[model samples]
Target: MTAPSSPDTQAENAEVIARQRVMRVLAQAPDQQLEELYEKFADKPDWTFARKPETGLVMTRGRIGGGGAPFNLGEMTVTRAAIQLKSGEVGHAYCQGRNQRKAAIAAFFDAAWLSEAHKQSVEANIIAPLEQEQLTAKKDKLKKAAATKVDFFTMVRGDG
Candidate 1:
């Protein structure tokens, strides 16, 4: 048995989960889309790069049949950035691909989200729209795939 988490711990955990969700949406968003959405923020805050955006290869792994033993799939190119806001918030982001600008923008958003003043606006303008777009795209893809699905049934013949 283990001790239950305190209220502060639970709140911290929720914050971490929310941040993860934001990062996931940012990572999946297209570069053009992310840039367009980012531009919506009129008064962008001043920030310095803790770590400038850089591209590198990361090894990917996969499990056989989605359940069996894991195996190294291959390497994937990823861009990552870290930024520190003048207000003392630090943010980091990792995006798949070699788009340095996208990674930087994502990191900026991450840091901005840490600020209580920007959290609600960031969630409303950036996170919500991106998540909706992703959900719509996923639904469209599923609809198309479902349309092509084949159903077959076996016929039985009576024999005496």
Candidate 2:
């Protein structure tokens, strides 16, 4: 018998591996914790912040009114953030909301993910939670929308 196929096994594997790599980098905090990582290279001249346009499309599968055929949604625009540590280490992130603080925090986590020692803590405390939260919110919204689905169908006689 043949084993079942996973359509996105490679992509999922890549994402998981990337997450692991980030985790490992964040585990090498020199200051005893990931939170203090910023001060480690705070004095570096490369440290700076910038704003830019980000774009993405969430390909979602859903039944119209919870019982119809699945369909795709269009793309969306987002704001991206970037921070360069004094040591030339760059942190980047994209968020749906235009919040500076969230961007800063994401950049901080990205920087921590770049650290070899503090990577695990950063993944556990920051990246993982945020990712989970976003997934949960998306699922909830989809479910709610599905609950209110309305179906309309019409039939016509051909050549009476």
Candidate 3:
């Protein structure tokens, strides 16, 4: 067995995990959501992209009942983009569906969040709102699923 990761490594891993969470939330949000966010920014930030937005299929996987065996969930359409801000922060995004503009917007947000000047403002105005909307939607979905759940029970026989 390997020893535990160092404190600095652990912190870096934590940040990576948080970034993943933010990106996942952003990717699932609707295109209009991002469009609104784009309008909220004051001045346009200069950025150079490594490549134009591209769409491709990605193979998705799932585990049987959460943790049993892994299985392929079939291919999904995804759009990806990578960009670097003028200040040198790089960001990337892979979003579900064929909306390349959504991916580019998300990537720009990711890069902007990397800078200390924009971190707090972006997190408050963009990430926080998106995350809250996602959480609310998730709760609504869970409530719908729970409403359809049926409880099965056994009754004892009086003759026994």
Candidate 4:
């Protein structure tokens, strides 16, 4: 016999639906993650996000040694993202600066919305880009640092 849907089951389903929406927003880069929610896909991944030009600032108010006054040290541009997976899984990520992780997770959820047949394609195209970018960035940084290595020389004075 089939079991009836209880209140607890309905609540659980609603929670699941909420999670899917969050994922769609965090999928785009950090800046795009904060977009407004619009449009919903049934067959494809559902949920939407939008972007607003917002400045994120990091300020050092003051310290005990230098507590004379407070000042803004730096600012960053931030974006928020969200995505809904095909299986109704949702994820979100908010980050400072343009970040690929924000986009990959979002794309991952988007791919999750697709049939298993399309998953590999989505992963290779969407997720792979970020991973490749990260690897390249790391290698370049190491190469640059290696190129800047310096040697120190010491001289001794002779006594007459």
Candidate 4 wrong stretches, greater than 4 Å = 1-44, 48-75, 97-122, 158-160
- Looking at model 3, report the run of 10 residues with the lowest lDDT sum: 151-160
lDDT of 1 at 60: 99
Model 2 misplaced stretches (Cα beyond 4 Å): 1-81, 84-88, 94-98, 151-160
Q: lDDT of each structure?
A: 0.92, 0.55, 0.87, 0.48
* Global fold similarity of model 3 (TM-score): 0.87
lDDT (Cα, tens digit) per residue for candidate 3, span 16-132: 898998788789889998988988876657898976799999999999998889999899999999888898888889999999899999898888888777878778888998899
Best by TM-score: 1
Lowest-lDDT window of 10 residues in candidate 2? 26-35
Model 4 error, position 24 (Å): 15
Q: So what's the TM-score on candidate 1?
A: 0.89
TM-scores across all candidates? Answer: 0.89, 0.44, 0.87, 0.41
List where candidate 1 sits over 4 angstroms from the true fold: 1-9, 158-160
lDDT comparison, 1 vs 2, better candidate: 1
| Residue 107 in candidate 1, Cα distance off native in Å | 0.3
Per residue, candidate 2 scores C-alpha lDDT tens digits across 1-160 of: 1345376776777766785554334332222333444344332244467544344444546688988987765544434567766555667765444444545545656765666555577667655654565568779999999999988665666852
Sorted on TM-score, best first, the list reads 1, 3, 2, 4
Count of clashes, each model: 0, 15, 0, 26
Residue 15 of model 1, lDDT score: 79
Local error of candidate 4 at residue 34 (angstroms): 16
| Candidate 4 lDDT, 1-160, residue by residue in tens | 1367689888877766654443433343233332211112123444444332233544434544576556665565554455555455544454455654445445444545344654555445434554455568779999999999988665665751
